[model samples]
Target chain A: MAKTPDSPLRVIGTSVTLSSEVQSRIRADLGFAIEFDVLDGSACLRRGVTRPDSFDIYDQWFHSVDVLHTAGSIMPIEVDRIDRWHQMAPMYRGAGLASGAPGRRQCVGRDPADVLFVQADNGLGREPTHQVSMLPTVCNADGFAYRRELAANRSGPESWGWLLEQNWGARCMLSQDPASSVTEVAMAARSAGLVEIADCTNLTIEEIDALFVLLNRRRKAGHFTRTWPTHEESVRLMAQPSTGLGSLWSPAYFELCASGVDLVYATPIEGYRGWHSGLCLSAALESAMCDRAYAYLNWWLSGAPGAILARQGYYMSVTEPLRDVLTPAEWAYWYEGKPATTPLPGPDGRISVNIGDRRAGGSYQDRMSAISFWSTIMEESNYLQRKWLEFVG
Target chain B: MVPSSERRSSSSRKTSDPIAERGGGYLYAMIHDLLQDKIASGALPVGATLKEGTIAAHVGTSRAPVRRALRNLAKSGLIRAADGQGYIVGKGAAVPLSSRQLYDTLNGGIGAVDRTVSAERIVQIVHGAIVAVMPFGHYRILESELGEHFGVSRTVAREVLWRLMEQSYIHKDRKSHWIVPQLSARDIRETLQMRRALEPQALRLVAHGLPSAFLTDLASRIDAVLADFQAVTAPRIDAIEHDICHNLFEDLQNKRMLASIRRNQIPLVVPRIFRRNFPLRDDLAALRLYDRILSALVSGDVDAAARLLEIHLDRAEALMLARLRVLSVLPPPRTDTWLSAIH
Candidate 1:
């Protein structure tokens, strides 16, 4: 598409994070024209890196900071321009890990903070700086979800091992994203004693080879129903009565719940997979449109957007604004580990939670503290991609 | 130095230069020297037939030069035209040499370890061919086919393999076959890191000795690419990288360090591989970095030039690694005649 000097700030991101409702609100409140292009995961990353001139602001997971920053596709976001800059210091440094987690200050691979801060030398680093790679937005702990009625055993502590069992047969589903799917598969395989993996976040060549070799055998035996890339596809595939379990994100899980599907989010004792999404300023953005971009970045930390994300089970960076927009019942049920006082709405404004029901993982802090690994690109990510594609083939 | 007929001897006396004596070019002189040595040594026996193509293939040249050499030999009474399309080694009328005799003459007792098929030229060509398709997958270099393709002995092909191995471009498998290893992200990262650390050190070493005229020429190349980004070609980008990453260090004096720097220039090859299927975009960002480094070098700011080279290497490693991951889905190109996919 041709863009002019006075064109609206063009934002590109996955449907997982970007929404039409946010576009409408940003257009009305920011007093500027806006356009959003929602693509699947791979297409969004490809477009963002290969053609930075195509968009103004990019919204996606922070794992892409290394890719986007290295390509010079994104510009630095000045922390000073953020309204609650000092107030959000704890979260900026936290990188979605709660202070009480098992390894309180240790992160094995990448997190939002690992590549978030901009150094004096104009490079990305972990230490806090006046500039950052992205403005941290919606983050949450994700886990596998399965049909409660279809599962063989329902009365015990759930294990990640169940997804790989032969009983699930062809009813099992998984994501096509290698970063998340590889880690999730390794966790399941290790839990089942099928293979031993030293670390899930960063995989070695031998471990990846071994995992895929075994996965190929399992896959050939009809262990997987299918693989999906977008949340919408996940919802459509998992809605089938015959589908047993699948790797799922919050949005799809909540959508299925609202549409009245019987499924359970298994917060395995092993832990939850943590992910953080954020907003970025494009390197090609015209200087005149920068102030409006800052307003939009600060707007994410304000009240309304965080509440909308909360309906999809995501927590914002600063919790104060979210408290104002959500009901006391919604807040307690979603953040305080309490039973729902009444039915809660999904992002689509449908009643997704019933009265007297409790979330599988408890409050926001409880889920955040249980994150086993953040979805990240490994040092051998390219090799892993090659092997993963061969396995899929 | 073998004695020819009096006519040949007189011709040699008339001119000290061998090419002038032969009335042909350098290739003709080379072919002449080779055939005369083989014929005088009785390697090509009295009845052996020497075809133009046979002499050409033996010395790794074209028929034109070999024809000149053979014709000159015939005029000197060394070999004469036979009834067939070849020449007879003996001057007098005689039966043409058997094909078996010619084969034996040309074979020249070549052993299993033949080592010199224009080693310098072959290594350069093979290295480039390997790098172009390396990102795809592991490839087995066929020694026999390599020899046949170059019209050299297997020993010469093996020598090329050894040279490639010394440069870390290929490896010997358990079967002792020469194989080019698959290119991986880690390979790209390590190469980039090595270049980042070494190139700046190299620039500092050779900076003072670099010629202003040479540096000016390189700057012009960068400006040419910048002048029209859309019109840039792969070979042009390659020449620019070669001038900076490679040719600039000819006077560095540190052999091991220079070799290491050359090894790390594989990032320059990644774009060439991709350019085969996609057009290269030499946009302002990369070219400006090149311009800045050259400007520093031209101004005698060695420290500034070195610093800029390090930054360039860092950015290069990241970009190359990403391109490699994108190409991971496609297997290595299967088009090379002498390369077979190991998988």
Candidate 2:
């Protein structure tokens, strides 16, 4: 099916990982028609896997690789085709890179590295291979952001339980994302001594029922009425004084802090919920469009775009490419866990990091190592989503 | 109040029951397809004026469903409306068949039994649709919508819901909402345990009285499927499963045991619905397992065949879960007018 050259290369992803700024930049640099569509987390994953003919590229969580690969929704991404495969993070390579270093400890949840490689059987596995289901693009460690007024100078490591605390009642927001939000709530329930779960990622139906019972009780008491579905909505809510806290991403947190809210992105002693985003070609994308989609994937690793993400507190898959792109001061503040000597402007040209401000949780290595969960589609994902609806009610 | 016998007979005469086919579509669908088949076969000749009452009596249904079938056919331009009453069979041909000849032809040709599509059929159709989507997520079934969709009364729709409720396929929550619950991993495993315990015994009962020719026929079908599974269609796969789950139990007089075993066959619905919407990617696991079971049965090794069937159930339970995981990522391709996803 040959297409007219002017037909845009449509890319679909959640709004958190995509921005109009990125769209404008890519269009200007590549000089082609590009369609950027933002969908809810589940909607994006659904269309990505089931309706590959709808878009050229899918940008979403690596956690989806299992279902995506199993459905054959995505084509195998050739590592040889990647411009900076060798420069990419070892953590994302395979099982061999998962040892004897600062990243020595194995991940607790569904590690992106574990399912990174496309095995000879055309399934995802930890075994190293040349082909991949997706190209790891951006990543971050997530937790809720809170107001200084809500904390009141309380000084120990923040607790995930703070989300369920009565003090933040009604003012507190919940994530609209079923998988990510439920994991956060499970951690909070576990941390607060409200419940004991064997694995936060994989909860039994009884456990899920118990957690939702508590959540429903709290919701009836008006504890978590507000929820945000997108990063923009998250920032909008967190920037308000009435909204004391909720689950959040780093970009939204930075946006809130930069807008001068005395916001604190929590580093719960429990651990951060780590998540990674990647680019995948739709099974339907072919020939010339395939070449263009690959070009778009390569552009993600072109250092400039990765640096843009770094400004918002995200780590690229290949950090080395970003070293020269980001200033020394900027790199030290964001990735190396140092206080900023000067105000750091985000990709938007706004001073997102104020003078003397330090990154939360610490550096890339510190936060990532402390991760206890990764955003993934659990085996009980369908059940979780079903009950998640009952709670969100 | 009406007498109980009168009420029951009144419902039986409602024909093309919405209660029996809210989302199921057994009676009317059969009528539509049968009439279309007749038209295509030249059994309903050119310019045959299908009067509502005549077609209804001949098909053992009410004029309402016949009128509906004719209206639908007219919409498709397969037939056209006559000025006096009812539809003329040909789109353009206008010489009407005499009423006597039309009645004689329909009476002699169509074999729709009076009770072939009554309450029991409703159980099958509604149950099948319900089971197919149970693995996807929780869905709400509304009585009013069900009634509206099936062109049945609310009380009839409620009766069908009650039958499904008795089976635990659906339930009325505290708010009186009809809910088809999601099949969790625990549910799948628990259901599988029921299948393993009952199916082996069923295989034993059926295999003991099974004809050599019957077993051979089933084996040949399996062999053909194994030879080139890609050539097999979704409906063909469903038929193959029915051969084991229903047809194989033809000799088994234990209706309760057969019902129990078939209830545990909800696992089949996942792959059935999935393969129908997606391409048939030949897992061949079912074919291979059935081949082994058939060989045992063919050798008069009834106990061995039962053992193999138990193993087949084990494999089925796992594959069902895997298919559910894959299906979870997509919105169900089939949703009823009466059914809505809870989320």
Candidate 3:
């Protein structure tokens, strides 16, 4: 039996799930059309768990692995089926076992059972379980961004505290996502000397109170210009003449640069907030659809998507395959964080990085290693969401 | 806060079990030691008031231990009664003492010795032990074993048993043995049902009375937690829950409602026990939902907060029940020597 256009494999994720370049490459390289359904984070999770029939594959972050698995909404993929399984970075393979730092653990890699291949009878063990919850894909570290023009006159080093400075009053913006925003704010609060938090990742009620008091006072004083709910809004906010500094995702930063905005994504002295995005199979997929999904997953790992994502400022799980797809200049500029030898195109094929342009943080390894924390669903996330809503209001 | 070195020393000397160290007897000693150290070091100014309720909330414990700690502080001459209010930091003895002398006195003097366990302390100790073991199954508690374990008289042990009976944690059998009730699916469902009915109403009643500054601060704290939800621990979740569901509602001053809410917290014992024995399980969805409810409350949308609270409770109920089922299948936890389950 042959698959037809009427029965395209359904894939659900956020708008930026697959860039146009990657999607086109999938069609050209894998010879299959994917029906993409882009939904917001909450909506995506709801649809993925409640109506598994609605999508065959999910492209999202690893933080939701536990929630999805617990809901019985996703099936484990056999590691043997993922042709590039052994090629994954050791940092991801060993997960958090390699990193012993207090707050630098990537959520996905921190728990082997959550992401690694597990056997049907055996749980999420360290050794190969022959099955995995999700196939690792593109990942990147996130940091704040600022208009170079606004920060040109600042005296001190680039710090997260700059977001809370009185000078940037009504000029700074924060993401509206509770997990990301709260973590950013905490980093800012700690850097600014407004509060002393034991663990910026897991703030206590008292520490939270101290941080928010400053935030509320600043908010009432018109310190914040906007709270963006989406990455597009974040880019828009950063582009606004009045907005000087704000939280930014890597893709957005690339988009802004491509649009000729003179902004510098700050590799703050504090550290970057890292995150990893991956692919998950829906449990409801039929045997035929499952094969197509595996093919799609394999195609992503075949180097084209990784190379495309690298152009947009993301590092793929397996860098070996990506090396073949990218030129030496591209690799040096993106991964090494060195000055670009030649102008590089953004994912949209627009000139984003001019020759001699350098990444703020030196090297992907340096930035990833310096991660003070990762975007996570904290234990107190319910309270966090409520607080975030209040902060937004 | 007590210095980590002193806390370690005192904790090691007191009990090996972490749960016991968190309970009333150890809490009282820890608070007393910490306050004495603060007073001796002059970190607590000469006139600073030490209110039991404030101290209890700060240390994440009940007023029982704080009250006892305060009494001990007063007895040691580190603090004196401040009119009709509460204990105030002071040099109560006729002899003028230097900071070093006071420090020496606190470290090696009258308050350093082990005090006889009172009936109240016995009650707290037994309650903590019961909660630590309740998930395993029904256990018969012998008055003689309880007395011998705590080095208390049988009369004192009987008082503790009576207190447990009053709290509905244990009941006397026909043979006069106190039996802890086996936790059932129905009990969990009922407890959650009570929580659903009462907690939302409590949030609604207290939402208006809460200070905007405090609520804003609370919202910010919640935001911080949500920002890194994956790294969150069970204790952190317990603290946040205390702030939203217990601490905020306690301000309503509804004695009966507050008491009923406290009593219905029976299901919390399961999670507390399970977490002590197992690695922290991910509860991100509940935390995310809680974040939304806090957002509503902070925005002054009392109705929305109440509605969200209901949904949050429902989700929590389901998650907790599921966890309870998992816990039930695991082997019975190792019993601490201090916690004797007589046949």
Candidate 4:
């Protein structure tokens, strides 16, 4: 892979401090001479390229990966050694293929889900695999990042709860992407007796409307702040005191914390949501490169270098064997990452799971179930999105 | 304490100062500081009636300096008055709700309340409310009844009269203000139907994405409504319920969607009477739906939360229909006819 910096084959990712550091670490640990091009992962994802010949790997939200896979541009992998890879979360195992001939390679890497890239301000990591196409990657822990000064001035997490309360809805800041649909889903789920939508396979209008009405209350209360068009805008909004409450990933946000912006990153005592990102080799990549990509994937999933990085400041989807990377202080900060688990909507107002359930290693079927649920939501997302636009406009 | 000669010299010194000499920057600064203090102290309340002659006398200055200060206050929304009323203390004597209030009146079923509000009462209240604060010469209201109120020529009254109607604040027929029209249950339902279609998604996005403080504020506001609802007597509940919901809808418009639901929809629904007695059942039902919605939001169940909103609107429309039947407000609901066309 002797390509130039702008080589069509170079995979680009939007990333910040920890991720950039991870990139350098991967280059050194693997001792690969190949140049790794790292850009803003979000921008590249939005570009939405499907041809594997042009870019060999993509590290972004897994939702986009599924979209690309559906487009038939990325090749899928079915290496026999896949079983050897460490599967921390079942999401790492990849989803079953529903279309195209069997054995057509799809998804190259082991766990793009665990990538450290996140929007800057809130530091909430990119979409967790659970919320997107299932891939074995890093599972992002959700938390709040506050401007150090503003956070210090406030008593504690309780001050931020004001946004979630009756009169304070407009003061909170969050990502507005239709893809990461967490904050909206969480509010709706809370209203629907804590029924999570991402986990459920089917959803009805009543459940959707209940969520909408709850949101409407917040709007009526004068609590909403701004609807950022992109993640970067949200990050910038979070970074300043003039703006408030950055909802973002743990590792990614830690870098912002280290830089001296006072932010409090916490999972709601009632549990917030996370977006899962992972690698899915498309059905179109060259077999040899796909094999190499799979090797890298397996290596990442095996959890040595990734574990070391996680110790530094990140959460991986697949359970890893790392010890002592995160100190007690860092662990306290990290423990709240997945503090609240949410339930997904099933059918007829029924729910599939409770948000409070502890997440553990997923059974093999978990990956498929999650994907099936996500696909269903995406299928109806256009309609929901249209309604959202019409309603809010 | 100074001698007359010294005083003359000091006065001359003032005239010779650079700010006074050219840009009058110092003079402006002094006046600004004085005005700022008066405003901050609430001594010079916004819209407090002011006369040019009195201000000039009080400031011990010519009308020019005072005029500049008035202009600045006017720009800041701190001072306003009716034409010939001079400067008042506040901005536009409390906008109450602008034309959006007409929406609430319609929504509250004003026409159907106990006795018919006579055209004379309507004209007096509407004209007094409008003209009491209307800037002088803003429009000429030529309607004869209104012209009689202002003792103005019919030509001037007609202009102002038509302007109000055009803004949808009021409606007029050949003889009287159109207090009642082709208002039907179907029209009100159709209008509400549009709100149901548009508001829920916008609200979900806002609740999902709004900053923390806004959310908390919302929760408290909802709680306040709950408190108010408990406090009101059953007979007076409808008005209170309408007020709380109206404020909430306005806030929603301001925060998200940015669409004026009240301005566009309330007018059509407000004038029609509730067909059902104790409209509070519908009102309470609507309020409870929102309460559940807020809970879901705190819990983070976006889909279920959104679904509830749709259900709430549907139920509310049903309640409206039932109330309309009680009041004999429209023909019976047709099962097969499309609702949108009726509006």
Question: What TM-score, to 2 decimals, does candidate 1 have?
Answer: 0.69
Model 1 residue B333 lDDT score: 57
| Order of quality (TM-score) | 2, 1, 3, 4
Which order, best to worst by DockQ?
2, 1, 3, 4
lDDT string, candidate 3, A39-136, tens digits: 76656765765567678899887666655655556888887898988887665554452263444534322332234565453234445566778787
Q: What does TM-score give for chain A of every model?
A: 0.94, 0.95, 0.90, 0.58
Q: Which 10 consecutive positions of candidate 1 chain B have the poorest summed lDDT?
A: B4-13
> Against the true structure, what is each candidate's TM-score?
0.69, 0.79, 0.54, 0.37
DockQ for each numbered candidate:
0.17, 0.33, 0.01, 0.01
For model 3 the local lDDT of residue A267 reads 80
lDDT of 4: 0.43
Ranking according to lDDT, highest score first: 2, 1, 3, 4
Query: In terms of lDDT, which candidate is stronger, 1 or 4?
Result: 1
lDDT by residue (B4-91, candidate 1, tens digit) is 2221222222332212323222345545666777789987777667888765565454466567778889888888888667888876
- Candidate 1's C-alpha runs over 4 A off are A1-5, A93-107, A152-156, B1-126, B132-166, B172-179, B185-343
Once fitted onto the true fold, the runs of candidate 2 whose alpha carbons sit more than 4 angstroms away are A4-7, A96-107, A153-155, B1-117, B136-168, B171-179, B193-212, B219-231, B244-260, B282-319, B332-343
After TM-score superposition, what is the CA distance of residue B285 in candidate 4 from its true location, in Å?
49
- Single out the weakest 10-residue window by summed lDDT for candidate 4 chain A: A367-376
Tens-digit lDDT track of model 3 for B121-203: 66766776787666656677877766655544466568788888887888988998788765654567788899899989988
CA lDDT for candidate 2: 0.76
Clashes of each: 7, 0, 22, 161
TM-score of chain B of 4: 0.41
**Tens digits of lDDT, candidate 2, B100-217:** 7777766754565323344466556667667777877888998887755554346557878898987778998899999998877777778789988988888877677776666776
Candidate 1, after superposition: displacement of residue A21 in Å?
3.7
